[model samples]
Target: MAIKEGLRPGGRSARVQDAIHSAVRALLQEQERSTVTVPQIAARAGVTPSTIYRRWGDLAALLADVALARMRPDSEPAETGSLRSDIRAWAEQYLDEMSSEPGRNMMRDVQASATPGYCVAIIGAQLQTILDRHPHEAAPSVDRLINLVVAPVVFRILFSAAALEVDELHRLIDIALRLD
Candidate 1:
C-alpha cells in the first residue's frame, strides 16, 4: 500500500486528484456504483486507501466529486446575445449531461451525500457566468433560475418514464424566460 508522492493534508496534488478521478470513472464504467469500493479505487488509482480517505473522506464523496467534475461544462456557456437563447443553450447542455447514465448515477450520489450543495453551486456558477455576460435585462437570482430551468429537468429525469424531449426543454426555457 504505497501512497502516491506529494501527499499533504489540506493541499492535494493535482496529479493525485487526476489519478483518483480517472480511476473512479474507469471503474464506474465497468462496475455498479454500489459495488465500487475505496480499496478498489485506490488499487486502480495506484494509491493507498488512506490516501483516498485523507483526500475525499469516503466513497460517496469521491463519486460525487467525480460526477460533479464530469458534469461541469467542458466549454463556456454559448453566448447567443439574448438571455433566453443563452439560458436555452446552457439548459440544453445541462439536461443532456444529466440524462446520461453516469450523470444520473452521479446526481444520485450527490443528492444522497452530505455535499449536495457542491452540485448546485457548480450549476449556479455556470449560470452566473452566462448572466454576467449580458446584464441588459435584470437576470434572475441563481436560485430562481435553478427553480425555473434546472428543477423541472431534474424532476423529469427522476420521475418521468420518457426522456426529456428537446421541444419540452425548449418550452421550459421559454417558460423560464417568460417568452410564452
Candidate 2:
C-alpha cells in the first residue's frame, strides 16, 4: 500500500519514499526537530527540496509522515479474549511509542501543526476496531474509552517532564476499564 496519500504507487516511488523516511529519521536522531529543514532532509535523502515540498507540502507535514510511519503498529493488536488485556496491550504499545525521543518530537510537530487531532483519531479508530471484536459488557463508546485511555497518557506526557512508568500506565488502563 502507498505510505501516504498522493504518492505514485510503484517501484521507484516506493524507493524514494523509503529513502526520504530513512533520511528524516536519521536527521531526527542527530538534530533537534526545529533545526531540521527541508533542504537538509532533501540533501540527505538525495532528492531535491522541491521533491520534498511537492510530496509533503511542508516540513511539519514531512515530520508527521515520518513520525506516523515509525509509530504505526507492525500488526493488529492481538486479541487476548478480554477487553482489559486488549486495552492494556494497546495502551502499553501507545505509551512505548510516545516515550521515545523521535516519537515525542513527532508529537510536538503534529501538535504544533494544523492537524493536532490526527493521532487521536487514528488511535481511536484502532481502539474501536478492537472493541468491535469483543463486545464490552457496558458497551462504552469509543470516545469515552479514548478519553479514558488516551487523554491521561497524552496529558501527562505533554504536560509533565517525567517519563510514564509501566506501573502508571497499567494503573491508567485499570482506571479506564474500571468505569466499564
Candidate 3:
C-alpha cells in the first residue's frame, strides 16, 4: 500500500517510517547523544539497519527532517491582529511544544546540529518565510523585534534553562510587537 506523509495504509513505507520515528524518539530519550547508533535505532524500530539507510539516507538527514517537521511553526501567528499578539502566539506555540516529548527530541537534535550549515539554513529559511508574510515593512527595528521575541524561547531551549515565566513571555511579546 501507498503512504502519504505520515499516514499509512497497509504497507511498508508507513510502518517503516513509524518504526523509525519511534526508535529515534525512544533512543533520543533513553540514550546519551553519543551512544545512539544505527543498529540501535534499527533494533528499536524492528527494522534492519539497511531499512533505515534506504528510507532516510542517513541519521543526520533523518534527524534533521523530523526535527524541522516537528518544529514547523503553527498558524497561530497568522491570524493574530497585533504584532504583539502574533509574537505571543508564536512563542506560546513553541512553549507548548517544548513541554512535549517530540518537542524535546526535536530541540535536542536541533541543538546538536548547531555546527551544521544545513541546520542553520533550515532555520533561516523558516524564519524568512514567516517574516516575509508580515504586512509591515522589514526594518531594522522590526528585525530586532522579531529577534527579541524569538530570543527568549531559543535561549531556553539551547541553554537547557528557563528564561521567562508566562508573565515574562507575555511582557516580552508586548514589548517586541509594539510598532513604535
Q: List TM-score per model, in order.
A: 0.83, 0.82, 0.59
Q: Cα miss at 7, model 1 (Å)?
A: 9.2
Summarize candidate 3's per-residue lDDT along 1-180 as a digit string, tens digits: 112456456577767777787788788788775688889999988889987777666677567556765555553244455444555565677666674656666766666544355434544554454555565843225456546755666666567555457777787766765557
Off by over 4 Å in 3: 1-19, 26-36, 44-46, 51-61, 73-81, 99-102, 114-142
RMSD of 1: 4.2
Residues 35-140, model 2: lDDT tens digits: 9898999999999998888878888778877777765667788788878788888888888778676567767767765665667778877888778878645446
lDDT of each: 0.80, 0.77, 0.62
Candidate that beats the other on lDDT, 1 or 3, i.e. the better one: 1
Error of 1 at 16 (Å): 1.9
Give a tens-digit lDDT track for model 1, residues 6-116. 667346577788899999889888988789999999999899999899877778778777876777778788998888789888888878878887767877877766764
Which model is ahead, 1 or 3, in terms of TM-score?
1
Best by the lDDT measure:
1
Models ranked on TM-score? 1, 2, 3
